[model samples]
Target: MILEIIIEEMSKIVSTIPYLVKYKKHRLTLDDLSTLANDSWLNDQVINMYGELIMESADSKVHFLNSFFHKQLMDKGYEGVKRWTKQVDLFSKRLLLVPVHLEVHWCLVTADFLKKTVILYDSQGIGLQKVARNIVKYLLKEAKEKKQSAFEMGWTVSSNEEIPQQTNENDCGVFILEYSRCLALSEPLHFLQKDTPKIRKRIYKELCDRTLHKKG
Candidate 1:
């Protein structure tokens, strides 16, 4: 339920941030933007560009698909009808960009049946829990329209010993979320390491809440 809510809320939030930042860059809310500034991984300029991309192509299917797939669909079809299909795939890839960036795993059973899973690594350094929380919020909001279900399942914040030093990649403060019956996940999923402020903020908020509420 939390995951679903987060996903839905975040979609709305991210959709709006780009426009707000474009015309109201100077007047943009610091508190809202602060959530994006975690360590050196993300900055104001990066955030602005990120928001711009989302804003400029908000209605475009290409942007939407890219966000969902997490990988650009390669054009591989003959001219005419085949080319038209390829173009559709490209649009899908773009539209799915944000969703895919946030989601690490996604699968589709049919045109409308889908499932998605997400894994946030290096969460401790930045603030992944908040990001996860936001995603849940967004999902929850969308569930009503999409008739979907979401589950936080479990989270694992790994330490050095948990992941060998020579593991090639860092794995600290990692968290996972699983989703079912999602329309966005009805396609091949791909991995992207690009920075997504909207997702980062949502996960950060979730983590902060969990940490603050801990019994200690």
Candidate 2:
């Protein structure tokens, strides 16, 4: 399933960006789509650190949870995410980019206030309707906790299949990081698998130079 998605995205990239085929031929040729294996943050420390840094700089309200926060929320339910949101003005938060780990792979779900929607971004091609529903449920629970009976799940819930994909197993972590980066800035899903190498370097440069919010 993941390989099929990667191939699909690769074909699109080749057609859209012809020069990428010359810069890195290996990107269009890797084929390691075996059994889906779960990766750890320890092995993927750089990816997690980039994700955490972006999440930390996102807002003072702590609207989104990333990396280890997934386990906390999955274990403790909506109250887990709410614990952080309560520290600041929850209603004032414009967006929340929660990195959700589904089984072995990683994906992202955004609680977008500007669009009044919950958008799912999965690079593996699997739609995350159920995951988006859970976030909506969490929002309702959060509203109720604040003594607001008017909260509802009427916000839009959808998935974006157009983002980048990994040609192999290990790159899912990188895809999650890129997903958070793009969505946090409210940008369109313009990145592709070919951008992964550059993104990995960009993370280090951004951290070193302290220039994450803008393109250089």
Quantify all predictions' global Cα lDDT against the true fold. Answer: 0.29, 0.61
TM-score of 1: 0.25
Task: Give the range of the ten consecutive residues with the poorest summed lDDT in model 1.
Answer: 173-182
Tens digits of per-residue lDDT, candidate 2, 1-62, equal 33344455456654545332221111112222211113222123344445556755665433
What TM-score, to 2 decimals, does candidate 2 have? Answer: 0.68
Per-candidate RMSD vs. true structure? 18.1, 12.0
lDDT of 2 at 68: 62
Candidate 2 stretches greater than 4 Å from native: 1-49, 55-62, 148-150, 209-213
Question: Model 1 RMSD to the real structure?
Answer: 18.1
Once superposed on the true structure, which residue ranges of model 1 sit more than 4 Å away at CA? 1-45, 51-115, 121-127, 146-216
Would you estimate the TM-scores of all the predictions? 0.25, 0.68
Query: Poorest 10 consecutive residues of model 2 by lDDT?
Result: 20-29
